[model samples]
Target: MAVQDSPPVPPNVATTGGKLTGSLGVGSIVFMVVAAAAPLTVISGTVPLGIAAGNGAAFPATYVVCTAILLLFAVGFTSMARHVPGAGAFYTYVERGLGRPVGLGTAFLALLSYTAVQGAVFGYIGAAVNDFVVSHGGPSVPWWVWSVGALAVVGVLGYRHIELSGKVLGILLVCEVGIVIVVDVAVMVQGGDAGMSTAMLSPGEFLSGAPGIAMIFALAGYIGFEATAIFRDEARDPARTIPRATYLSLVLIGGFYTISSWSVVSAWGDEGAITAATDNPEGMVVDTAARYVGAFTGDLVQVLLITSLFAALLSFHNVLSRYIFSLGNTAVLPKQCGRSHPKHSSPHVASVVQVATAGLLIGVSALAGLDPVTEVFAWFAGVSTVGIVALMLMTSVAVLVFFRRSRVDDRLWNTVIAPAAGLVGLAVMLYMTAANLPLLVGGSSTLAAVITVVLVATFLVGVALAVVRPPATVVEVTTQEEKK
Candidate 1:
């Protein structure tokens, strides 16, 4: 039976009343995406955890494996970038390939995932800043105070202009990356405790002892790189910029993670690294800095960790705002959120909503006297990881089906084979995430199940919305006629 083709929408349709204005080239986009990953923050916080609880010295290899899978995912991901240039990104791609209901559901999932993760950062950053100040004999306020203030600052940037956010992220990202690189270089020059052996990258190390956990942490680090397509409206020559940025960001993120992690393992001697991490997971990197470089540099890295979290928060705010704007433009959300700043050409309304939503959550957590890192950050970050992995799996399949149905490209690897490969890897990761749900979200089975149910229910709500109030017109890839 021949599949009937859906009518394609006009190419480059301005769904939002006002288009986002920016000339963000590859470098700008890379900074935005990688900043969301927050290198120094991840190394100082997440890496030690991975080393201690995950695969030990082999943790560095997990990043390489994750990177390889994502690179496969990106093969079809970047291919679809040329076909669907909408800011909706996964939503647009899935809707065009699958259907409106699924697309709408994916959008809901995307919003929940990005917002949750962004909110998670606030919890951690607030705590970090509060500790920094109190330990330094400064005024002591509740962590939520810092979280709310940081939210306000990012809210302003997100509401203003893409270039402003880009420049801000650029400066923060450089400092964060530079500081980590300095530590890495220092470790290398000293030849580490184990004399700089390549054993960390060995196959035995990579395959040994619960590598799945390490891979989860590694995958979380690379989450924001996929947002490259979400900025299509503001990209300069998106067809070229998006693909280049996608690959560039992936490579840079992967290489940086691999090297930094390996250096850390070497710093303590690959054998003792796991013990060092286990002993003091939080301050392993800082302590290593003090020992390897100098006490001053160690203090500097601690300070940079706060800025790293801030950079990540701002980057995520931009992404979540765009997601809200895309839904609003499609009438899935309030029309007000669809409006952009006339002068700044940014998603001001959605940005405001982002800030308001985050503030409300912070207020609730504060009132409840919840631990920001354990209760707020852990739960949201875990759920977001699950949601994102699911989205990636859907997107990989969407790429394959879309290309097959449209027959727009005759190439096999770009459309079919690579996506198939990517889907398999993503599915495995999704399964691993679900299996480790309790561990990911504070080790409470009941809590994990509740969060899982919420994720499922969020998608169902989106599906119901699509059925109850259908879009006046469904958006799809441009047909030959529409393109012309």
Candidate 2:
């Protein structure tokens, strides 16, 4: 079927093999969870620590708040996705729904966010590995080793077919989720040493911290959902599968974070929860497991933590590469960027670009004498949040615009109102991020903060370029062979 009526839908679009099928059932949904949630491997104790230092037991409640907000955002985001199917995600949504200028702006920002996210994961994986190495007392490998290792692994998987990447990710997802459930259940069985506390629900708990810190970190857990469209070509039913993945990802993340946070609180004994979390955020789960379960089991959880972060790196690489590929497909990029690997059926050139950029950034940071964890996680993540925040704002607006112009009244619920709410919610998060940019990256590292600033400025520059000279008209990307 030709995309005659749908401007955003390319003409001559086909049910292409390269495109993800919509059979995205529970397994696909679960793969998303694995990608998005595994990053919590590094986030778990870290978020609670920020809370302990700032909020308290109430940190768990904050996770729930983000869950609701993201759910609202998904309503709009997914609603738009149904009409506009591409790996560019928010960028495509805003471009078609809004104006080209706005669309390109969103696209550029998303590129920043996705690429920065990949960069951020590099540091995170390095840190996870470093943690493991240091714990072993074998004179921990420099963080660069972790970065290199991640590059090698992510590069290899990305060089192959999506299914191979999916399989590897599926295994990691299962293991990570298994560990998270194991920790939560183990804590529950052990019971609270001092009973449940009211702090889990108190507003005062969240208000106590520089609210920005908690909100920003909480936002980190939601990053992988941006990849929802990455599987579009593989989903069973694009229209249905994409929307379901959107909602499923949001709900699963929110619930998973909530339960995990509460389990930590329960393990700590109400009053001491946050403080204990602060003293040892990365170690909190480990300590909790050791306390309630056994040393052997706690050690196992720590090992899985490394695997979880690695899984996150792998997932984000795939997401970012596809984004690159999408940009190339539109001829908005270098012709080479859009080319798929003839042998592997992968976006080889784009994949290499992502790996190279990540390596260069990580390597330079390490050589320049900086902590990869702080530089990678705080700097790139904070910047990406800002960029994604912009996407959220544009997406929310696009939802309203698309429905406003189109005869599609079905979108009033999911596409219009809910997305509007999400936009508002994300805007609040962005305000918080800007106000507390320094704090997001520890507010302590001048270098990290500087790096973030430069990145944001560069994004603006790209937006400026798109304004000066817009990209050529998008042509039919799929072919007759693809339709067959």
Compute the lDDT of residue 83 as modeled in candidate 2.
61
Candidate 2 off by > 4 Å: 4-26, 39-43, 137-139, 204-210, 444-456, 468-470, 473-484
lDDT of 2 by residue, 286-367 (tens): 7777887778876688777777777777787877787777766654566567677766667888889888988888888788
lDDT of 2 at 192: 70
Query: For each candidate, how many residue pairs have backbone atoms clashing (under 3 Å)?
Result: 0, 16
Candidate 1 local lDDT, 1-80, one digit each (tens) = 12222312222336545456689999999999999999998898888888887888889888888889999999999898
Model 1 gets an lDDT of 0.86
Clashing pairs in 1: none
Segments of candidate 1 deviating more than 4 angstroms: 1-16, 474-484
**Best candidate (score: lDDT):** 1
